[model samples]
Target chain A: NAGVTQTPKFRVLKTGQSMTLLCAQDMNHEYMYWYRQDPGMGLRLIHYSVGEGTTAKGEVPDGYNVSRLKKQNFLLGLESAAPSQTSVYFCASSYLTPSGGRQVEQFFGPGTRLTVL
Target chain B: GIQVEQSPPDLILQEGANSTLRCNFSDSVNNLQWFHQNPWGQLINLFYIPSGTKQNGRLSATTVATERYSLLYISSSQTTDSGVYFCAVGDYNQGGKLIFGQGTELSVKP
Candidate 1:
């Protein structure tokens, strides 16, 4: 399995520009998430989906929107880029362990580095 | 909302040295995890220890759920171990959402 994969490994945008990040997972996970990592800090969730066609806001959901139109794909959109939005973005997927451990161990993608100037 | 704090916040170690990183949460959590973020910015799961103890090779972790704390032990550390370690905790009640600590930056020198 390819696990989780993120498109546009790196991107640069001018303030007010817009873009979308695509995340795909082959593990058939029921949950997917978008998170951002800033310098000197840990990752923070921007949005998440409990299942296909369902999306919810997370800790840092402002300035971003998300959609899960398909079971294998989740998309994050930036309506208008801002310098404060420049950070390393990561996508993760997880599912309830079949072993009944109830563990939600997340798998992450390679990450996309975005720079908003 | 739950809060997580990790310490000592930063550490420098000589290769082959042993160190312990700590995580303290403000509330009880059913899910706790330890992650290592490499210098290249990849987050790798070290342990899914919400309670008791679990060990993988030179890395081990223990979470005392009753005390609302967890500890990560890295024995005989290597240069490859240089990076940030993060502790995340959450409960099923919160949609499996994780609250992360500030992270402990570890630098292992050869």
Candidate 2:
């Protein structure tokens, strides 16, 4: 299994440009998340999905959107890129119970280095 | 909202040395994890310790849920152990949302 794979390992975008980051997990996980890591800062959640058709905003959900149409794929979209959005983006997935009781370990993908100019 | 804090933002040690990294959370957590992010930015899961202690090779972790803190120990450090160590906590009541600490950067020199 690839665990988690992210496309476009690296990218540079001009200001106001838009793009979507694709995250795929072969672990058959039920939970997926998008997070951004800035220099000297902790990873902040951008968005997450509990299941195939459910999505929710996280700590730093502003300036970003997400969609989880399939159980294995989670996509993060930037409507208009900004310099502040430039950071290493990581995609993670886990298996959790439907009632939100037990927590599972998260498997993270090799991050994508994004530069917004 | 939950707060996660890691101590010794930067640590420098020589080969074969041992060190401890700490994480303190603001509230009770259902899941506490330790992750190592290599220089290439790939995060590797080290442990999922919410309570008690667990050891793997030269690395071990302990989480005291009542005190809302966790510790990760690295023994006989190697260059491969050099990277940023992050402590993340998941709130079960909040639908398994993970909050991370700023991470402790460790530099092991041979």
Q: Number of the top candidate by lDDT?
A: 1
- CAPRI-wise, candidate 2 is medium
**TM-scores for every candidate against the unseen true structure:** 0.97, 0.97
Chain B TM-scores, listed for every candidate in order, come to 0.98, 0.98
Instruction: Record all residue pairs in model 1 with backbone atoms less than 3 Å apart, i.e. clashing.
Output: none
Model 1, range A1-117, lDDT digits (tens) per residue?
999999999999999999999999999998888999999998899999988999999999999999999999999999999999999999988887787446487788999999999
What tens-digit string does per-residue lDDT give for candidate 2 at A22-71? 99999889889999999988798889998899999898999998999999
Candidate 1 TM-score on chain B: 0.98
Which candidate comes out best when scored by DockQ?
2
Report lDDT (Cα) of residue B34, candidate 2: 96
RMSD per prediction, one decimal?
A: 1.3, 1.4
